[model samples]
Target: MGRNTRKRRSPLATKVVAGAAALAVGGGGLVWANFYASAHESDSSHHRTRSAGAQVATIQCPDVGQKLRNVPRGARPGVDKELARLDEQITEAYARLASTRQAQSGDSAYVQNAILGPLKSKRTAALDRIGINIRRGGGDAPGGLDRFAECRGMGADQPGNGDGDGDNGNGNGGQDQDNGQGQDGGQDGGGQDDGQNQGDNGNGAAGPFADDFVDINDVQPNSRDLENGLAANGDGGSTGSFTAVCGVNENNLFNSDNLIVAPGVDNGAHHTHDYVGNQNNNAFSSDDDLAGADTSCQNQGDKSTYYWPVLRLQDGTQEFDANDLGGGAEGNVGKILKATEAEIKFVGNQQSDVVAMPKFLRIITGDAKAFTNGVANANSSFSCTGFEDRQVTDKYVLCPEGSQVVRTSNFQSCWDGQNIDSANHRDHVAFVQQDGSCANGFQAIPQLQVRLVYDVPAPTVENGQVQNPYAVDGFPEQLHKPITDHNDFINVMDENLMNEVVDCINGGEDCQ
Candidate 1:
């Protein structure tokens, strides 16, 4: 895809909320899986992680008595003029913030404090002035532009965004680590301050990890392989069951200065992701990067960035055990590894043809916010001892004796055949039907699935406390909390493999 084509996007008709610049991806630690659909159909079967009926705080501007300006509802001529002027002022203020001193790539607080902080104050003041102007002009909210004020710093997941009803999960507010580590290499380390790696405190928390630490071997055991339940979807492509083994692309795995979450927001992921296939991929990594980065794929041209949160394991002993990675500074999560293979599979859609995904299109599956938001669109599965069939949600299942634990995620595969992205990032794609056929107007694409198998040891109980052997990377210090993890894929497939995938799906032939 050319840069010019990628750059063509609709302008923001309404002002985004203030503090938007600081809204990191997975901000508050809850990944905002902002997938979209024209209309969200609430399925009773696939429940969310949180109570669907939970109430979310409504974001609004300073009350201007009886009327909130509605941007969609145009204002009176005079009121419109004033609103336009204020919009310009707000835009200018944001520009000023952008021009402020630039912080180091991973310095999280620099943007929040120096840029967003001051910009918020200025915007809030300007909004307040707008209210005064509206009053002076003898108008009520000048077409609900007043409501835009409520969106200040709020994400698309928040309420009053004209989207469907669903509260963004509650994200825990803490500090960011400059050295990118906490006590003893734990996340949000709350115990003894045996300071190791320390980073610029983003949210003013002492560090990412606490004083206490748990070895990977010490974590409590969860699910394991079930007898006869661990079978792969046999008979492969005849029924749309297949696997695409994207080989290990070591060069693609690195500490990214760019945050993959909010590309516009610097260091938006806040934490680093283990990237594969694309060495130059990062937040703010442009079409140029996508077009230019080296690929570890056999094609030698595919640069799609496949990334996920970092995983950290304990070291040999206390003398070496650390929770840091990404440069392994003291107080940092240590030792990132490249997966031997990222096995993307297609299950359920046995009869659908795999269409080629558009270049530069971004798609995310699963919900990182699932933990706090209740399980929605969850396709997480687990296995042990090479058995791949067991799947469960919510609680982790203890594996059978002698089996290692594993996690699997399957992404939605039906596409609209038109738009590569939508407002919510999900509307453009739909899941295949029970028979594995795409809905009318949607095309079948290679169903992408990911499986992560860890080398965690057996669980042990110490002094009545159960230590699970495996936990996801980037979680808080607590062990085995039901986590909401997700995956992201930007299509940079080389034309050869892309065509082969399409043929496999269309011809009803399965191959690894």
Candidate 2:
């Protein structure tokens, strides 16, 4: 059942094309061109498998290439060490373009014009040695050196009023200004085309986190994006029939050091992970770099290693430090794209029979010390939109009229079919049969779902501080309150899409 489509472009379009080199050339692997959207194949012969969030159908728009003149009029003392070695050569050319998913390979256009085009003229000649004011499009316009659309909140468009901050007031720049009359209609500057966000599938209209903060690709599932598929329960609940989407690449979810935890130690997981598909991972990484890395996950050898833990929104009095990194240090905070979009559903018995999912598995969903420990780890979900039954630590939750603001996580699908790699990473794995099937000895797999969206109402001081309109990158600095939000996954699935998710749960078929 794979028929679905929606396309839209021109959000600052940029193209380069050309792919298929299979990368991994120098070593740290990263190929390219591996996209899959839908496929059902299962005509009795048995041995098909592949229907759990099969996404990656075109999500381009990150070229931020040319745009940096000559500016060397003021303090140029090695301009912060040449913008920290061009931020480690543009995060190693986006980790070799996320290990060759090929969006213009040839080493990602030679690291985007030989290392992000002269590191975008030494980051505007070191922000013109202080004095602030690069203003081309405002919102801290770094363009040329391409901060990758500032992790896709869309580098300062300013006016969407969804409130991430873009109209130049500076809480970090805003753009998604709604008009469809949703989040109390509109805020910031209720007009048209200032930062560009009117409506008609453009987001900024139809409000309230409009189907996952709109960059638009076919997010028509309104009602708060199906409000957790209407509380999908277990058994024959069919759990919204099936859902699977994973078109990510927002700078591999906050990068700088490359996660190594032991062997020589890199940044390790000291806070920072949204990752998605394999790029070689960090916290020390292994299994032969997950069998020679390179994946955004379309079966390309399924080099496992998906990640989590990077949500921290509380700009009420300042708490959004997604890695900072203007001059380096303070967590570097660069890569941006995920305004909220990564789904995968299948809670119970869409069919059930499951198996094939044992390759270095290490899933851990939610509770990263749930705000210093609170216990409740059953699948894990936090709410605040009409008080979906209430559960708060208050990182900034006002919600009232029509309600909105949520963070959901659900993994742990009772595996044990074998062993991938586990010590304490979560006892082998278990938890499914609540009608979803498996239990007893344990088997069933595939059930990711990691929803996150926020509209944030109340609190926006500005100069005096207090900003937080829902942000996340890697929490620490006193845990930004909000019960220390959490999430983590690592089941490099791709032994034929984990045997087509065990033939779509033993052939009950209902794919995405």
Off by over 4 Å in 2: 1-88, 91-116, 119-155, 158-222, 225-234, 237-265, 268-282, 285-307, 313-347, 362-386, 389-405, 410-458, 461-470, 474-487, 491-512
Per-residue lDDT of candidate 1, residues 181-251 (tens digit)? 11222212122212321211221111222222233232324433211112212243334445555564544
Model 1 TM-score on a 0 to 1 scale: 0.53
Residues 1-512, candidate 2: write the lDDT tens digits: 11101112112111101111122222111222221212333434433332322121111222221123222323222222233233333343333333332333223243345434554554445444322333322324344343432321110112122221111110111112122112322221121212332111121111112211211122222323222212323455333334444545444434322222111223323344556667666534566766677776554655565565544332212212221221012221222224355554544433344456676666665433222222233133436544545433223344555555666666666666766433223445654532445555766566656666555454343221233234333322111223334566666665776666556645556665
TM-score, each model? 0.53, 0.31
The superposed Cα distance between candidate 2 and the true structure at residue 122, in angstroms, equals: 13
lDDT of 2: 0.36
* RMSD (CA, angstroms), candidate 2: 22.2
